[model samples]
Target: MDLDDHGLTFSADAVMDETEELRNPFPSPPSHYTKYTTHNLDLLALYNERLPDRRNESQAQILADQTDVPDWPLTQLEKPRIDWILEEPEPYYDVFGERWFVKDKIPSLGEGGGTQLYPEDPTVDRRPALLGILRSLLVTYSQLTSAILAPPPSINLSPANTEPPKPEWEEKVEWITVLAQNLMAAANDLRPVQARGNLELMMQRQLQLRREETKALHDKCDILDAKLNELRAAAQLISSRGDSTDVAMSDPTPTKVVPDDVLAEDVLRWAEEVE
Candidate 1:
């Protein structure tokens, strides 16, 4: 693996297993194809050009050792000789196309009932492998015909079923019942305490409200007291003004000197008026 700024990279092997994946990278169909658009046609052409060439089975299985799993190495030479004659000649392609090809029947070879043997490797006896395959098939068939198993599958736990056994279940139920009863008793016991807490909270809330009301009243009193002080000052100013005014009436013009002579004459008249 080579590390680069982008990411770690590795050389891709000629892994023919992903042959189908090459087609996936091709351009997809356009949304509207009612009419031929130049872009769409161009894309189709490009897609055709990019398509990988079809490979023969032998060539596809590059690692011959690994390809033996699917491809027959023996198929390289020629199709095996079959004795039975068919009305139609079997079709075949040299490059291993969609269909396998069979050559014209060689009337020279007689009917054979067994699998083809490796003539070169004469020491290879296929009887043992055939018997082993037959045994496996028999075992598989027997298992398929056997009775159905209805056993419940276990989840995360392995020791037992998710549901406990009867005795353990009963014990659990009893314990739950006792727990519920205890819970009920405890709730019953806490009722008075809970109520007391609630009442205390209410009392505290009421006290807070009363304090607010008192503060509001005090604010109003302060306002009124200020108003009263203003009024008192105004009243004091009026009283002082009235007290500073003249206490007795005074003549505007000066008293005349003839007033004495006139007063002597007026005194008799005044005495007469008084009498």
Candidate 2:
């Protein structure tokens, strides 16, 4: 579908995205039904709006000078949310993470540490974050209700060993090693499953091929056996004719010769025996 047909052109969005200014340089966005439907309100209560010291002046004087607006303030959207989130946010840039162990390792820019990472106020170590997300998901999605249905808490079965605590760096290295080993073990476990499937497929294909070959050979043998039976019947018929002719030649009178009807009867008996 053409954009013109649907009245859904993206030229404005493309221009706004490329502009990258505090205010969009492109034409004002076309008004939509949402603009009319929204109930916008301004909730700004800045310190600058505070009345001059109440303790230093009389109540009447403060009342006379009061300029506070009542009820709903105004549309805060007029204040521009992008300016609040990203644009010209110089006053609060000094804030930093709780800990940045790799600060020095990060390559220096022209002025300061390389760059501020996204949501750059806290160091979220991978293990804790992952575990927190996992725990939250487990709690939120678990359908089991009864304690009897719940899995038993795991307990260590190995004998306790008294060993000195390792340094932080060594502990980090151990964590990394364990993570790598876990990944490798998972991969190894999956490898055998895939190999077993592939091997089974190949074996089944070969077995099917052998079965087809065996069936073909059996069919050919049946055909050859049928032909051999036919040849044996023909040979028996020719031998009967030869014997009858010999007997007729040995007879003293022509009357001793076998009649055509008797010969046909003998041939029919031989055919029945072959069947």
Candidate 3:
């Protein structure tokens, strides 16, 4: 049968025999007659002219190009075809008017009846990474608390010694501070649009406040250390003078301990706010 009689035409010089019926995944609808042709329809040239890489291409032009020349390497040959047959052929296009051409009949995992143990994007579910970071941070904070409860290291409070007393909580504080900072960064990176309600900003602000609090604690500890040093020096001077009178040294100022309860409360508040 003449392919033209059926309103369909293709190159007789194609690798496939023209006598055999051509395979058309997108068969024209019976109700809507389609006159497929390739005359003067340089699909590549038309695509280059109309659908530029970074230009406003019309939807009609893109769909026409995709339907005519689906493959790029094989689109060089101008095979037999026609022009417009139906007012609107069934085709899908993106918001940018780019046509979505079908290359294969492979069904997606959703419809193929198969289990996708892993998603295409590993970070699609960031809960695992976020949870791991949070757990590490919690453990670090717990260590800081324990270190605070632990006895301060022995120090020689001598004016001549010139050894500045380091606070026991300082190391632990730094660890927790670094961990908290990392957690905040990770949280921000993994923030989903659906769950976002200034949550990333809140986390950033909270981390900043935590750093400020830590700095204040460090300052307080320094002041206490200075006072303790002065008292020790006074006692030493009195003893050197061979004074029989007892030189009573004043008690060192207490350092503020960061409570884990406060941290827990803040986390709970964030959760509630998000909810």
Q: Candidates' TM-scores?
A: 0.28, 0.26, 0.23
State how far residue 14 of model 3 sits from its true place (Å). Answer: 74
lDDT of 2 by residue, 1-275 (tens): 23643244547675455444324444344433233323322222222233344546432343443354322223323443644544443312221212333223322221243222222222443345345544543443343233335556544444574554444444444444444443344344356568999999999999999999999999999999999999999999999999999998898774746656577778889999999
- By summed lDDT, the worst window of 10 consecutive residues in model 2 runs over 91-100
* Pairwise TM-score winner, candidates 1 and 3: 1
**Whole-model Cα lDDT per candidate?**
0.48, 0.49, 0.56
Candidate 1 residues lying further than 4 Å off, grouped into runs, are: 1-174, 239-275
Prediction 3 global C-alpha lDDT: 0.56
Ranking by TM-score: 1, 2, 3
- Model 1 Cα lDDT, one tens digit per residue, 116-214: 212223255634644554465455445434422334334464565566334433444444444344334434445677999999999999999999999
Alpha carbon lDDT at 254, candidate 3: 65
Candidate 3 on 1-275: residue-level lDDT in tens? Answer: 23653244556554243222233444334321222335324554665565556356443446553554442232334333333222236433332223453332333333455332223353487566557757876887787788888886777778787877667578767766665655554444445553675787888999999999999999999999999999999999978865543333343666558565578778789999999
Best by TM-score: 1
RMSD of 2: 24.5
Best by lDDT: 3
Residue 96 alpha-carbon offset, candidate 3, angstroms: 34
